[model samples]
Target chain A: MTDATPTFERSPDLPPPASTVGVVGWLRQNLFSTWYNTLLTILALWIVWEAVPPVISWAFLTADWAGTSRDDCTSGGACWVFIKEWFGQFIYGRYPIEERWRINFGSIILIVCAATLFFPRFPYKLWVSLFLIFVYPIVAFFLFSGDAFGLEWVETPLWGGLFLTLVIAIVGCVFALPIGIVLALGRRSDMPAVRAVCVAFIELWRGVPLITVLFMASVMFPLFVPEGLTFDKLLRALIGIMLFQAAYLAEVIRGGLQAIPRGQYEGAQALGLSYWKMMILIILPQALKLVIPGIVNSFIALLKDTTLVLIIGLFDFLGMIQAAGTNPDWLGFAVEGYVFAAFVFWVLCFGISRYSLHLERKLHTGH
Target chain B: MAVSSEVGTPPARASFWNDPRIRAIIFQILILGGIILFGIYIVNNTLVNMESRGISSGFDFMGRTAGFDIGMTLIPYDEASSYGRAFFVSLLNTLLVSAIGIFFATILGFIVGIARLSNNWLVSKLAEVYIEIIRNIPLLLQIFFWYFAVLRALPSPRQSFELADTFFLNLRGLFVPKPIFEAGFSAILISFLIGLVAVVFIARWAKRRREATGQQFHTVYVSIGILVGLPFLAGLVTGFPLSWDYPALKGFNFQGGMTLIPELVALTIALSVYTASFIAEVVRSGIQAVSHGQTEAAGSLGLRPGPTLRLVIIPQALRVIIPPLTNQYLNLTKNSSLAAAIAYPDLVLVFAGTALMQTGQAVEIIAITMAVYLTISLVISAIMNWYNKKMALVER
Candidate 1:
C-alpha cells in the first residue's frame, strides 16, 4: 500500500585500489604475498645474481670470438676460436669440401618439401609429403653416397657431424613409421600368432638400450650376415636405430589406436568395410590425428638418440666436438666446443617441440 | 521371401579365399613361416661367418680373466678378476649410480615441478628455463661437458678446491670423507630398524584412531621424531662409534678417503639433471590433472591447504604421476649405459665393450647384455602394471 518512490542509483565501478593494481601491486602479489614467497624471491634473485654474470662474462663479454687460432685468443676467457675454426668439421664431419654442396642442396630440398607439407595453405600437400616420404630418401641417399652421376663416392665412415646426425634421424623416423604402423596393427590383430610375433619383436627391441643395440650391430651383426658380405658401419648403425625406434613408435601408435572409440569400429563394420579398408580409410586417419603430438615427440626422442651412434665411433655432431676438443692444437677448448654443440641441438629440439605445441593447439578439436 | 529364408537359415559359405577366418589363418602362417625362415638363414650365416672369422661363440669366455682395470668398482676388481666377476662389479656400479641418480632426480624434479606451478613469476620462469635447457640437449653431450670440460678443468690435488679440509675436489675426482662404522654402530643401526617399525605401527594406529573418532593425529611429526630420536639416543649411549676417513693430500694425489671417480660424478650429474627435466613435466601435468574443485571442496570442509594437498589432492595426482614417474626411472636405468661413452665401466662398458673385445665372443656377449637389459625392462614393466592396477580409480 505504501511503496516508496525513493531508489538508490548504481554508480560506475571504481577503479581497483592503487595498492592492488599496476606494477607495484603485481610485484607484491606475485613475489612477496607471503613470508615464504618473499624469502624464495630473495633466494632466486641471489642465485641469478651469483650465476648469470659470470656466465655472461665467460661466454660473451670477455670471450674471444673473432680469432683464427689458440694464440689469437688472449682475453683470458673462453676460446671460441676453437669452435669457429672447427665449425666445418662440426657440421659436415669429414665430408669432402666439394661434395658438401650435395649435402646443402639435399637439405634445401628437404626443407622446401617439409615446408610445403606443414604449410596449411599450400596445395598438393599430400603429393609433397609422398615425395618427401618416398622419393626424397632415395635421391638423398644416392646424392650423399655418390656412386652414380659421375660423382665421387663418399663412404659412410666419412659421413659425420650434424650431417650424419640428420641422416640418421630422418632415415630412422621415415623407415620406422611404416614398420611401427604394421607392428601396431599386428599387436591389435585378432590372430594370436600375429599378435605374439609383434609383441615379441617390439618388446625385444624396446627392452635394450640403443648403445647395446649399436654394439650388436657393429660387432655381432657381421656374424649374423653371410661371410664376405660386410655392411657399412653407418648402415649397420642406421638399421639398429630404425628397428629400435620402430618399437617405441609402435607403442606410441598403439596408444593412439587404443584411444579410438569402440563406436568407430562398430560404425566401420556396420558399413561392411573390410578390416584393412576400415583401418586404412577410417581408423588410422582419426587415430593418427589424435596422436600427432606423440609421433612428433617420438621423433624428437629419435633425434636425441642419434647421438648414441657416436659411442660406436661414428662421429655425429657431438662426436665431432669430442674429436676436435682433443686435437693438440685446440687443447683446453672442450668447454667452447661443448657449448656450441649444446646450443645447436637445443635450437633444433626446442624449435620442433614448440612447433608440436603449436600443432597441438591448432588441432585441439573438442572431444 | 528369399531374404526372409536367407535370414532364417544359415548364410551360404563364402569361398575359402574370401573367408575372414581362413584369410587370418593364412596370413598368420605366412608371417610365422617367414620369421622362421629368416631365423634359420641368420643362424646358418652366423655359423659360417663365425667359423671363417675364427670367433668362437660360447659362455666359456666368462670364466677367463678380464685383463683390464676398471677405473671404478664397488667390489674387488683388478686385471686378474674373471669376466663374470667383472660383470657383477659393473652391475653394482650401474645400480649404485642409478640409485643415486634416481634419488637426486626425484627430489629435484618435485621441487622444480612445484615451482613451475608457483605463483611467483620469476621462480616459475626459472624452472621452465631449467627444464627446457636440460631436456633439449642430448644427455651424452651433457656428460661430455661435465666430464671433459668442467671436471677436467679442476686443478690438481696440490691446488684442490677444499671444503672444510675433509672434502677435496680436483682433476682426479671428488674425495669425500668416508664413514667408518666402528664396533658399537650396530646399536644405532638396530635402533633405526626398531624406530622404523615403531613408526609404521604408530601410523596405522593414528589412521585407525582418526577413522574411529573424527580427529586428526600428528602422525608425521611423531614418526619423524621417533625415527631420528631413537638413533641419536642409541648413538649417545654407545659413544657414537663412527668415524670419517678424511682425505688428505699425499705426494701428488689424494689418499685415504673414498674417491668418486670423475666418470661416476659426471654420469650421475648428467643423468639426474637430464631425467629431472622429464620427471618435472610428469609431476606438473599430474598435479594439474587434479581439478581445482577438489581444493574448494576441501576448503568448504574446513581443511587447511597442507592437509588438502596431502590427503585430497596428492593422492589423486599420484594415480597419474606414478606410471610416468616409474617410466622415467626405467629410462634413467637404461640411459646409464651411456657411461660406456665416458669409460665408466658400467655393464655395457665392461661386459659388452671390454669383455666382448677381449674374447671375440660378440654373439654370446651381446646376447647376454641384451638379455640382462630385457630382463630389467620386463621386471620394471611388471611392477608398473601392478602399480597401475592398484592406483586405478575404483569406481562402482
Candidate 2:
C-alpha cells in the first residue's frame, strides 16, 4: 500500500470565461439564443419603433395640452385641450359650481381614510377601519346629499363624472363584501333551507346581465315599491349593483372556504365552540385572508361594472365623457374625451390590480 | 383524559329552545315566512302599479310590430316585422359578433401567451406590456376607445384607406369584397364537407396507428390538402362557382360590398383585445403549471422540443387552460351586452331596448333577454364541462 501511494495535483482557480458572464452573455442567453429569437427581437423592436414615436409625439410634443377651446387644437395630434377645458365637467358633471367644494371635502375624507386604513404600521387599523366602514357612509351621505349642516341639497341626478363613479363603486364594494360573506356562509350552512335561499339568490344574480339588472332597477323597481313612496335612482342602482356583485364575491369567498381543510371545522367543534364562534375565531379569519386576492379581483370587477350606470341614465365617469363629447362646443373631441377617460380608468384599475398581486405574493405563505 | 371522560359520559340533553336542530328549523321557517310575505307584497304592489300606470305585461306583445329599426342586424329586419323577429335578428347578431370575437381572441391569446414565454427578451417584454395594459383597463372603456377614437378617426367613405384591392377602411366601417355563390356551388360545398369528414377520420386513424405502433404520418398536410384542395378541385370542375362582389364608388358612398359596420367592428375588436389578455394569462399560467420535469424527461428521451411540446406539454397544459378559457369566453359573451351602449343592436339593444320601449313590457322583455343569455351561458358551460371531463387524466 505504501508503494502504490500517489501525489495529487492542484490547479489554481481562474476567472469565468467572458462568454458565460456579463451583459453580452445575458443578451446571448435571453435575446439571441436562437435564429427565430433574433427575428422575434427585431420584430418587437420594429413594433416599438412604429408605436412609441407616434404616441410620444401625439401625447407630448405635438399635443394641445393647455388650451380653453377646440380652436387651440391646431396640431395634427391629440386635442388634449378638450380634456383641459372640460376637466371640471369631467370631475363633477353639472354638480353646482358653488357646491363643488362638498365633493372635494368628500374626496379628501376618502383619501385620508384610505391612506390611514391601508398603510402598513398604522395603529388600531382594524378598529379604525370598522369605524370608517360603519360610520363614514353616513358622513359621506350627509356631505354629498347635503340637507343637513345648513348646506344645499344636491340631488343624485347632478351626481355625475368621477365623483359619482367612486360613489357607486365604493358603496357597492362596501355593501357587497359583508353580504357576500353572509351569502357564502349561508351557501355552506348545514341548514338546507338557508343554503337553498342563498343558492337561489346567488344564481339568479349571476345568471342575468348587469345591464338588465340596472334596467330592472330603473324601471321595474318602482312597481315593487309602495305607491307614493319612491327610491332614489342612485340608491336603486346601488341596490342592483350590490346584489349583483354579492353573488360574484360569494363565489370567490366560497372558493376560499372550500380550500380550508375539514380538520379545522372538526377541531373547532371538538373545542366545544358554537358555529358562529367557531367561524369567527377559527375559520373566517383564515378563509377571508386566503380570499383577499379574490375579493380584490371582484372589487375591481365591481368598479368596472359601475360604468353600466350610464344605461340607467346616470352620469358616471364614462357617462360624463359621453355627455361632454356630445356637447356642441366639444363636438369632434370624442377621441380626446374617451382617451382621457380610458387613461384614468386604466390608471386606477391597473394600480389596484398591481396592489392586489403584491398582496397575494406577500400573503402567500404556502399552507 | 378529562375531555375523553367528559365525552364518555353522556351529556345532559339541552332544552328544545337550545337545540340546534329545532332552532335551525325555526330559523328556516322564519326565513321562508319572510320570503313568502315579501313575494306576495311585491306581486300585489306590482299588479296595482301596472294597472294604474296602464302598463301591459305579457308575451302577447311579442307578436306586435316592432316599429323600430335595428342597425347591423344579421337577419332581415324592418319596421313591419314582429317583435319576435326583431328578437331573433338581434340574437343572431349577438351570436355572430361573439363567435367572431372568440375566434380572433383565441388566436391572438395563444400568440401573446406563447410570446410571453419566449426566449427573446424584447418579445416577452412586449407581450407582457400588452397583457398588462389591456387587462388593467375596463372593457367598456376599451370599447369606447376603439369605437370613438380609432374607428371614428378613420377617413370617410370617399377617402377610404385601401388594404389591398379587396379591403377598404372608412368611417362607415370596413368594406370587404363579398363572396357570392353562383349555380353549382353545392358541389364545392359538399366536397368541403366531405373533406372535413375525411380529415376527422384521418386524424382518428393517425392517433390509433401512432398508439398501436410507433409510426408517424403527415396527417396535417394530408388533412389540409383534402380539405382545401378538394374544395378547389370541385370548384374548378363546377366552372368556378364562387364570385366576389367588390365595392366601387357609386354616387357619394361605396356600393355593393359587405360592410362591417363600425359598431360591430368596434365591439369585436375591443372584445377580442380585452378577452385575449385574460386568455393569455390563463395560457401562461397553464403552460407554467406543466412541471419542468416533464420537459426534461421528454428531452432525456431524445424527443425534439416541438414534438415534446405537442405531445407531452400541451396535453397536460390543456387541462389547466380549458376551464379558465371557457370562463373568458363566457365573460366575452356577457360583455357583449355592452354593445347596447353604442347602439350596436345586439340582443340587449334591439330586444331589451327597442322592443321593450315599443311594448313597454319591462318585466317580460327583460326576462326574455336574461333567459336568452342564461341559456347561451349554460350551454357553453355544459360543453366546456364535458370537454374538461374528457381531458381530465383517468385514474384507477
Candidate that scores best on DockQ:
1
lDDT of 1 by residue, A40-112 (tens): 8999999899999999999989998887889999998888888889989999999998889999999999998
Q: Look at candidate 2 and give me any clashing residue pairs.
A: none
lDDT of candidates 1 onward, in order: 0.91, 0.89
True interface contacts retained by model 2: 0.79
Q: Which regions of candidate 1 fall more than 4 Å away from where they truly are? A: A1-14, B1-10, B213-215
The reply for model 2, stretches above 4 Å from the true place, is: A1-20, B1-14, B205-218
lDDT tens digits by residue: candidate 1, B36-84? 9999999999999888878887788789888889888888888998999
CAPRI quality band, candidate 1: high
TM-score of 1: 0.96
